[model samples]
Target: MKTIDLRSDTVTLPAQSMMDAIASAQLGDDVFQEDPTTNELESLAADTMGKEAALLVPSGTMANLVAVLSHCERGSEVILGDQAHTFMYEAGGISAFGGIHSRQLPNQRDGTLKLEDVESAIRQDNVHFPPTRLICLENTHNRCFGMPLTVGYTKSVAQLAGDNGIAVHVDGARIFNAAAALKINVKELTGSVDSVSFCLSKGLSAPVGSLVCGSAEFIAQARRNRKALGGGMRQAGIIAAAGIEALKTMVDRISDDHRNAKILADGIAEIDGLSIDIDTVKTNIVYFSLKRLEIAGEVLVNRMSELGIHFFELSPHTYRLVTHADVDENDMDEALKVFKKVMADL
Candidate 1:
């Protein structure tokens, strides 16, 4: 049986074209700024996101951390959603390494911090409070059913931050997915932010790497932060080659992943013991819950795994599945069959 892996888009393999590009790529030391292929990738990334320049980093975590470090000084505070990947998943690198403080606001069901709430959270210029230096937003919010934040909402946040002299950084790991879902240019989503970090590994199908886009001066600062964090790479063109291919070939097809997610969501809704808010199936992520209280989420997940299907159990009752470049419509159908059978037997 073909094992259906739906855990996350991060599981996707690079395309054959990416491999070809890597094999023939020109190589040089990236730390010295002499790698031609890596330079090409950075220029392409900046152009794609409508930014002045871009810097390559090893992973999404490092990209966010570098962006935060470049924008804020020690003892400065950044406002972000409580459920943000930087806060919830990135191991608190910003606070630990940069001594920057975080002020987390509530993320709504649509994955936006209310304007009023954000305004209230900004610290006053008092001696006791850390000065607010930055605001962070996540596009295609992971925990919020992978919903894409609207262009209007992003501009509103940017305006708020600008008025307060705070820089805005977007953890845009799945930003292309957001653009495809919204039927808008990716630049429209990123134009207002001061800096944005996007992943090449997820959905884009690059083996490894992420890029941080911003003004040239900001990128120069971020490059220094990357080196300080031990993120600088030598002969990184081999990785950049694949990232170039992913950018050139993979972005247009993200809508297919979104379609497959809807298929999976609709199929799960038909199962007697499974439930999902079908309306929230906006991007490549599908989140559902086990309505049968007798069966725990782990039990169902284990049973499905044994049956050649795999996904994530987010809680005792909630589960998450993501569609990506590797998993096709047939895989969705097969996974849904397994889900139905497993739910019935349990």
Candidate 2:
């Protein structure tokens, strides 16, 4: 427990500078577009992602919901990976609140959706079928071992979406991690997409918030939708100040987290009872099955927590470890030692 917390990067604490910025931020009613700091954050985020405008929302989940509600009308369909955070973790807000239909495709080991499959899944112009209006993808996909969707892969799918007259949306909550890992520009990765939503809190270590960026016209529509969903907040500059700091300073250090993930993965791979495909780990999250250990995933999670090392399990047989800013090389070593001891007697 002394060293690592591998549950998720969402557990990361904000840096002192960010805290100071938040404490001293100038805030006004953001619902009235008067929070200057929030406005600046949105402008910078939109520019960074190569979009026309952006909106700040309370969380990445809300960002995704706002995007869906803005793009798809009730009874319309949106295509996405089955394992995507928007599909699997957002509690079907798009369906519950917007009445949107989701058309799901399997996520490959590399986190890219097959373009051919996406093309075939598009609904025809028929009265009975819900029209496919949007195609969604995740970069640095959280579920697929934090795998990064390559630029080529995204372009191919974006091409398919364009040819089929469907809009493309990227749930890029960990896009900076993706960019840093691939050593590519963020704008280049997102330029062809119709809209994108990324988190400020996860790897960036902002206390809370996410952003949705797209065409000016589209963003205007999303702003209205945000208010409709009660997502509009007043005087939100405190959070946006932290977001600004994260975008400025925390991005470059993500590779340290990526390197730590590899370190921990390599160590756990050497443990007798774990199975990990280190090759599939392109970013910060690591997933492996602990079947040989003959313990439930939750049991392992509890044991790890009690020992001051923490991790999350995907299912009964699958466990995951996510490295973040706080988990240094020393923490990785300590985690491995704990893993070996816990698995030795089993």
Candidate 3:
């Protein structure tokens, strides 16, 4: 049987073309700001996103941390959704490394932090409270089944952040997915935020890295923060070359992954025991659960693995299925068959 890997888009390997770009990439020490390809990628990413400057970092986590450090001072607070990647999945890096505090509010099913709640959470210059310096958002929010937060929603948050003299940072690791889902240019959705970071590795299929873009001054500070975290790389252009190629040729293709995801979600929903919100499969990630099953999630996961169909856990009962460049029509069909077989055995 053919293997279907639906764990995440981060599982995607570089395409042959991207590998070629990597092999031919020019090299230099990026810490010296002389690596031509890294410089070019950062410049192009900044221009593409309508930001004053951009910095390349080793991973999305580094990009988010650098942005967090640039936006907040020690003991300052940053507000974000309780389910957000920055708050939940990032291992509390902001608080640990930057001495910033996280004030988390529950996210709506659609992956938005309630505007009114967020507004309420802003710290007054009380002699008693930690001052809130930042508000963060995620696009194509990972935990909410990859739902795309709308521009109007984002602009409202940005405006609210502005009202409170807080800078807004967008953890846009999959912002292109949101843009494609909303039928808007990625820049239009991101233009209002104070700083934004978008991944080059996920879905875009670059070998490594992400770009953090914002004001020139913010990026300068972010560069220093990156170095402080030991994120500064010498001669990083070899990997950066693939990032440039990924941006140039791969972003627009996420629509196909979205389409395939919809196909999988809709198909899985038709099964008797599978429970899924088809509408929530908005981007590349589809999350669903099995209803009243005798089988445990791990057991089913193992069963699916034996069938060469694969995914991962989000919770005790919930499973996450992601569609990416490697998963095409044939893979989706195989996955559906595996699902049916597993249900039958149960």
Candidate 4:
């Protein structure tokens, strides 16, 4: 049987057109900002996000890292959802390398931080308290079954942040998914935040690259921070060329991933030993639980892997499945068969 990898959208391989673009891309030393293809990609990314400028980085981690460094000073604090990729997945770069403090609040199941909680979390001018300098949000929030945050909520948060003289940053790694789901332009989602970092490697099907978009002055500072973190790359346009195509062609098709994810979630809900909230299977991510069963998630994962189906076990009894450009209806059908067989044996 062929492998059906639903581990994450990041597992998607570059398309043939992307590979072609990579081979023929114009190249130059990016340190001096002479790479035409890189410059074009950055410009396009900035415009798409409605920002004054953008900086390309090696990964979503690096993109968020530089954005954090740009927005906050040493010993300052940033407010974020406890389940946010920045607060949960990132390796404490903000606190460790930048001396920034993180203040985390519980993320609602729908992937939003309570405004009242945010208001209460802001530090007053006590000399001993760290000032809150930034507020971070994730669109298509990863840990929340990839729920898409709305423009109204984002704007409200931005207004609150502005009232407190704080900047807002969005970890929009799968922002296009959010846009496609909401039937809104990408700018509607990004305009409220001060900066946004989005990935081309995820559902976009690019081999690698993420872009950080923000004000021209902010990007100028972020570019310096990228170098401080050893992120400067030479002849990077080869990879950037694929990113350019990803933006041009790969965005609209993400709707198909969303549909496939719902189909997988619906099928899982029908399985006797599994449970899922089909409504929460938004965008490309579907999270399900085997908690009702006697089997451990790891064992079930292993059993499914043997059948050429792969995904991540989020906890001892929970698993996460992500649909992407590569996986289709046929792949989901095959995966469902494997799931049923594995459950029967259990």
Candidate 5:
């Protein structure tokens, strides 16, 4: 039986074109800025995000960390949502390595921090306060039902940050998905921010890589931070080539993943024991919970896995499924059937 893994977009394997690019790519030491393929990818990434320059890093976490390290001095603070990936998932790298402090505000259901809340969270000029140096936002926010932060909201945050003499950075790991779902140019989502980091691995289907885009000065600083963090890769064009291929080919089809997610969410909503807000099926992520308290999420997950359909049990009752390049509409339909059978049997 074929296994349908809906755990995350990060699970996607690189396409054949990406593999071919990797095999044929020219290689040089990226640490010395001599890798032509890596340089080309960085240039392409910056142009795509409408930024003056870009730096390639190993992963999205490093991209965010490097961005923060470059933007603020030690002991400065950054404002972000409580549910943000950087706050919740990055394992305190910012504070551990950079001595940066974080002030987390409540996240709206649509994955935005209220402007008033953000403004209030900014520290007053006091000897005891950590100066707020940056504001962070997420595009296609993962924990909030994959909500895409709108362009207008981003501009508002950027404006507020600018007025307060603070910088803005976006943890845009799945930003391409956000652009596709919103039916807008990706640049519009990123134009106002001081820096934005996006992943080529997730949704883009590259083997590995993330790019941080910003002003040339910011990227030069970020590049130094990357080296300090031991992220400087030699002969990295072998992998960067795949990233170049992914950007060229994989962006436009993300809408198909969004469509599959809606279909999957609609199917889950129709199941007797499963519950979901079909309206929140915005991009490729579908989140649902069990209305039948008697059935544990792990039991359902394990049963579905036994049937070759795999997803995540986020909690005892809550579950998540992500549609990616590897999973298709037929896989979604089959998974729904298995989900129904498992719930009924349990």
Candidate 6:
């Protein structure tokens, strides 16, 4: 049986066209800024995000870390959601490597931090508190049911940070999904922020790479930080070529993944022992709980694995499923059938 992998969009492989582009990629050392394909990808990424420039990094973690270090001084502070990927998932690189402090505020279910909460978190100029240097926001927040932060909310946070002389950096790993879901241009969400980093490896379907976009000066600093972290790649246009293809052709089709996720969420909700809020199935990520079922999440995972279905266990009872380029509506239907059979057996 063919496995229907719903664990993450990162599992997606590049299309054949991307492989062709990679095979024909123009090569030069990216560390020396001489690769034409890498330059094109960076330029395209900057144009997409409406930034002055962009730097391609090895992964989203390095992209965010570079942006953080570029914007903040050592021992400074960053304000972000408690559940944000930067704070919860990035292995504390900013604090570990940059000596920067992170102050996390609650992330509302809709994946927004309250404006009042952000205002209160900004530190005063007194020596008693670590100086607040930057504010970070995650688009299509990974852990918050993949909820997309609205342009209005992002602008508000940017305005708040601007007035306080603090920079705003968006961890936009799934930003294209956010743009597709909101039916708005990606620039509308990224316009006011100081920097935004988006992943090509996720739903964009590139094999490996993420771009950090910002003003030219900001990106210059980010490039240095990326090198310091050992993220520099020589002749990296092989992957950058695939990224160029992903950005050009794969953006609009993300809506199909969103549709499949909704279908999956609705189907799972109908099962007697499974539960999910179909409304939260806004983008490609679906989160459901095995609340009514008596079986443990681990047991369900093993059983599902035996049936050629796989997803991430978010907790002892909650699980996450993501639709991507490789999985289609038919695959979703098959996965749902497997889920129903598994629940019935339990």
Per-candidate Cα lDDT values, in order, are 0.95, 0.90, 0.91, 0.94, 0.94, 0.94
- Candidate 6 has its poorest 10 consecutive residues by lDDT at 291-300
Which is the winner by TM-score between candidate 2 and candidate 5?
A: 5
- Candidate 2 lands at a TM-score of 0.97
lDDT of 6 at 345: 88
Per-residue CA lDDT of model 3 for 20-127, tens digit only, reads: 998998999999999999999999999989899999999999999999999999999999999999888888899899999899999999999998899899999997
Tens-digit lDDT track of model 6 for 284-344: 9999998755666788888999999999898778999999999999999999999999999
Which prediction has the highest lDDT against the true structure? 1
Residue 95 miss distance in model 5 (angstroms): 0.5
- For model 5 the local lDDT of residue 281 reads 90
TM-score of 6: 0.99
- Per-residue lDDT of model 5, residues 286-305, tens digit only: 99998888765688888999
> If scored against the real structure, what TM-score would every candidate get?
0.99, 0.97, 0.98, 0.99, 0.99, 0.99
In the range 289-326, model 2's lDDT, one tens digit per residue, is 88665565677677777788887777777988888886
1 or 3, greater by TM-score: 1
Model 1's alpha-carbon lDDT is 0.95
Collision pairs in model 3: 28-235
> Residue 269 of model 6: what lDDT?
86
lDDT of 1 by residue, 277-338 (tens): 99999999999999888766699989999998989998789999999999999999999999
Clash pairs detected, candidate 2? 1-307, 1-308
Give the poorly placed runs of model 5, Cα more than 4 Å off: none
Candidate 5 has which clashing residue pairs, if any?
Answer: none
* lDDT for 179 (candidate 1): 100
Model 4 lDDT tens row, 157-217: 9999999899999999999999999999999999988999999999999999999999999
Candidate 3 has its poorest 10 consecutive residues by lDDT at 290-299
